[model samples]
Target: MLNIYKMYSEFLSSNIPYGGQYASVVKLLRSAKREILKLIKTFLEKDEKKPHIGKHFVPPLMDAVLADYARNFPDARESEVLSLFAAIINQYKVAMKDEVPRIFESVFLCTLEMITKNFEDYPEHRLKFFSLLRAIATYCFPALLQLTSEQLKLVMDSVIWAVRHTERNIAGTGIKLLLVFLNNFKKSDFCNQFHQTYFMQIEQEIIAVLTDTFHKPEFEWHVMVLQRLFSLVESGSLTEPLWDASTVPHQYPNNADYVCECTIKLLSSAFPNIMENKDLYGEEAAAKLLRERQRMLLVLGLIAPKMTDS
Candidate 1:
């Protein structure tokens, strides 16, 4: 097993065409999956007895695999490489079982770090990275549950970054992942450590993104962010107090005034696009525009009462 890992590591570092070399390596790994799984199972047993896997092998192995993935398949279209890595990680999850917490922590943190470092270099892979994050949130949530407050804050920052991403699809996925994180954890999980101030910052960031005007055709994508914010508001997980008034850059005496001002601004920004070419566009386009306009209104309506009471 060590020999195989060594060979694979060397191959990844060698001067070879990544596409061809990666395909051959994947085939070899697939063919040896059973044997590798057995070996990992044994290593996991040894980890229980000696703590070596957690302390030594798992972190480096995860690092190596992720580096290879990032170096070779830094494009969204490289689905094969993405699938191969996902499969490899899933198999590790299966074999590690009880030992997955440590392994997952290493892998998860590494993945976040990789994304942070390489985000600009591989803009096309943003959605793919987000997809991996969603999988982590879905399948390895227990590991996520074990994150320290600082680590959780890092994750939140990443989610906010994703939500603010320029690409509509990537931002939409970020909203979905944010919802998943919120659903799985109690409000206290985030608020307890960071306090309402941090959440207020998040809300401010989200609202800033939401206020941007997109074309009529891109309205649904904009609505997704608003919907997620609405969900947070409705659930009482994100409260009116957490809405930062300063995000609007207007001098208001109180939160209510600030919110109302922002609400009017949002309405003004959206209304023109919604009303523009209402009769000129096709039925489907008009309907979508109207729906988006309604969604924006709905979000403002939901928050208006709270803002008023504030």
Candidate 2:
């Protein structure tokens, strides 16, 4: 029998080393795998019950299984790992149907942690790992049904940091996965943290790269970041993106007027009554653009013929 109690006790202990062993963790995870599947199968077969949110978000049994699985990564062989990976993948693909997370709780989170901790060291397994992550909620919602905000944030941060951008598909997978988390994690410190460091560069520096990719109709990419920004705007946090319309990089790099017009339009929609309120963007600036809807003409007219006198 797995000493799940002891294992979880150790994982919970904040003590630095905790004699943490992966073999024990792996053994614990493998042992619980069958039981987890059984529970998921039953959950799917049964009638819906009102969600019984336990005192903790995760049950003790699931927590123990994860802690023990983390113990196994050290000695696990690449060839021997196919079954575990397959189980996770299969469970993920059918997860939403089951309405549960099919994997052990700790294992899923710890797997994400391991990926982030070793991302630079293991370039080869990045795709395989990212694919598994992509299936996480979609494939196996049972175990993840009651995910905490903190847990979701960790997964989001890890997945976002994993994309090295070798190919468009890989980039798409990574970004798509982050989009999932971003959609769920609205108004959290995650965005604030991302902006302080990485996302600022993603927008301020790499807007051209992302926008060009989105512009291609075949990509079918969701402009999820904009959705998130709009969600923030609706929630009264973000009014609009910070990029200056004229200077924001774009495929039609010469079309500064178009960019400015789009920014003005979006800002107008995002901030209610800006046009009607003279105290805000000024009756002149907002009125000319909003009432006539010729945002470019209005802005250009303001700056254009002034050059004629010079």
Candidate 3:
């Protein structure tokens, strides 16, 4: 195993003279990385007595990728290497508590700077970057607890940027990443702080997208995100207890009620005749109108309770 790892490190650092040869070598490295990850997973699964996987295997692999390959040839290998890191994060997240901050700096931030100059550039990196973010947010959430305020904001900003992008896959990944965060990190102080900072922004974004015809396919996910957000607000789970030093934002004394009112008013304005006779339309049109009204009512149902509670 150590010999294989040594070979992997050497391959990462090696400068192949031929471009074609380098591409082939990278393909080979990708395959090897996956197999090695599977082996590590199996070792841990089988309860091997001394799986030196985390210490000996992962650290060296990270160093080779970060120091040797990435520094030497910046954007050349990020998409490939980040894919590997994503898998490693899923596999070894528990052991990665202390390492997440460093990994986020080296891999996540570097990739962000590389690809986020414009929406069109580094398209592959854009997709892989969100995938990597999802991996971190999904498996290594506790690791996120270690991040300071600024770092966490950058992470959330990245997700927001992704969800707003024109590309469907990237946007879907971002939406799902938000779902993962909402579902997983329910009551942490950091989670509440994040909600305080960006909940309205995120809520508005999701609402806008949900209403946009372009995002029709993401409708279910949009509904899910709202459901979770509404549930959190309705339950007051996001509120910092009064005993804590932190105070609620004065701009919105009750977030759910504010959102509920805004949403109802928006729906009423957009569909002024929705409350009128659907029977005026033909059968097909009336059925479609009914479906639209039902969907809107479904969303309103989720919000109305919070308004009443507030």
Error (Å) of candidate 2 at residue 60 is: 18
| TM-score of model 3 vs. true structure | 0.67
| Per-candidate local distance difference test | 0.55, 0.46, 0.71
RMSD of each: 11.7, 13.8, 9.7
For model 2 the local lDDT of residue 88 reads 36
Model 2 misplacement above 4 A: 1-69, 73-106, 117-119, 141-145, 163-170, 182-224, 227-310
- lDDT head-to-head 1 vs 2, winner: 1
Tens digit of per-residue lDDT, candidate 1, span 1-310: 6457545545544523455647776556544543554456455544543444445765565564444544542221233333333433443443334443543453445446555674465554466667666666755666665667677777788887787766677777887787666556544455433434454465556566766753233355546645654555445554335444566454545444444555566655756766565566698897997787667666756546655443
> Candidate 3 at residue 182, lDDT?
78
How many clashes show up per model? 0, 18, 0
Runs with alpha carbons beyond 4 Å of true place in candidate 1: 1-6, 14-120, 123-125, 186-198, 213-310
lDDT of 2 by residue, 106-223 (tens): 3455455444564354443456556656665445534443557576556545555543353555566776766655554443444544333333333321233344543243133435
Candidate structures ordered by lDDT, highest first: 3, 1, 2
| TM, every model | 0.48, 0.39, 0.67
Error of 3 at 84 (Å): 0.7
